[model samples]
Target: MIELKSPGEIERMAVTGQFVGGLLGELSGVAAVGVNLMDLEHHARRRIKERGAESCYWDYAPSFGNGPFRHVLCLSVNDAVLHGLPHDYVLRDGDLLSIDMAVGIDGWVADSAVSVVVGTADPADLKLIEATEVALEAGIEAGRPGNRLGDISAAIGAVARRYGYKVNGEFGGHGLGRTMHEAPHIYNDGRPGRGMKLEPGLTIAIEPWFCATTDKIKFDNDGWTIRSADGSRTAHSEHTIAITETGPRVLTRRPEPGEGAASQIKQAAANS
Candidate 1:
């Protein structure tokens, strides 16, 4: 069943979102050439412990994945998109890395992901990452009340087409709140004016992930990492948002370089 959040519940979610977003921002800075992927995972685990937040991925045993996920982060490298299992891999210059994370704070859950190029960035890779980011914003903008859920999907698909990227709809976004995955399966591509009508207090995660070549994806031998079928590079961007009377409030919004979590919390309160 589809569940909605009350004002107080949304506020609680915003607090969790702040932590998720802040941690992602910090991880992005820490990701550099020569750094081991395991190091990033350990850093994220430490931060989650320090903040008293619970990792949504730890011990998560989905039907498709291997027994249970034992890590705190999904570190996807070039060509690898979703559910990336971190291994003993060293970062190299020009390698595109994507970090996906979700955490629960005080019973509320927030999930977010970002893609960045380590060390020297290729122009094409940067463009691909930018397209996903722009697509994520478009999807969020379409989450306002009175719009259909497919409207968000259509908006995201349009952005992908505009950027000359093919979208894989198999593992797109979904409704997330008290848990990581909830009802209302959101596709990356769909027709507008279709699906459930948006309503206030409806919170969902809208993620746009794309590959430079084909729209097909395959799983790795580890039974978790998802990579492009054509061996093409990929990028992913996501944000958790709440549909409100005023508009769509982005709960997991990453703060600016100099911005603090207090400011983000204040902004969320003002929006509420």
Candidate 2:
């Protein structure tokens, strides 16, 4: 069943989301060239422990995933798109990386992801990353009460198509609450005005991931990493949003106090 949060519960979710957003913002600042992928995982572990929270990815064992993910971070580098398992690999200049994380705080869960290039980014890479970020914002804008879930999907897909990127089929976003994943599967592409109706108190993760070439993907030997079939680079952007009587409220927004969109946009550009 699709779960809805009370106003009180939504406040609790926001608290959980603050930690999630803050972590991503901090991690992105240090995801530069020469950093080891394992170091990022350790950073995530320390942060989660320091906040008295638990990692949703570390013990996640979905049927589609390998048993017990065992890593605190999904460190997708270059062609690797999703569910990337951290290893002894060290990042190089110009490598595109995506970090997906989920944490449970005080019984609430918030999940988010961000993509960035290590150093000396390619123009194409920067564009691809920008497209996914724009798509995420578009999807969130369509996630207000009275709209259907498809509206959000359509908004996301439209941005991808506009950039000539193909949407991935296997995974997108999902409802989030006490658990990491929940009901109401949010597709990357769909017809607007269809699917579940968006109502107040509903919270869902809006993620848009796209490949530069084909939509097909293959699993890495680790049994967790997913890469593009044509070896094309991909980008992913995600945010947890709440459907309010007023509008959509982004629970996982990254900008700190006194920071504006210009700064956030600059952060995205710098990552590229």
TM-score of each: 0.94, 0.93
Q: Candidate 2 regions off by >4 Å? A: 256-272
Tell me how far candidate 1 lies from the true structure as C-alpha RMSD in angstroms.
Answer: 6.3
Using TM-score as the measure, the top candidate is 1
Cα lDDT of model 1 by residue, 132-189, tens digit: 9999999999998999999999999999999998877789999989999998999998
Q: How many clashing pairs in candidate 2?
A: 0
lDDT per residue for candidate 2 within 114-233, as digits (tens), equals 999988999999999999999999999998888899999999999999999888767999999999999889999989999989999998999999888889999987789999899989
- How many steric overlaps are in each model, in order? 0, 0
Name the weakest run of 10 consecutive residues (lDDT summed) in model 2: 257-266
Query: Model 1: how far is 237 from its true place, Å?
Result: 0.3
lDDT for model 1 comes to 0.91
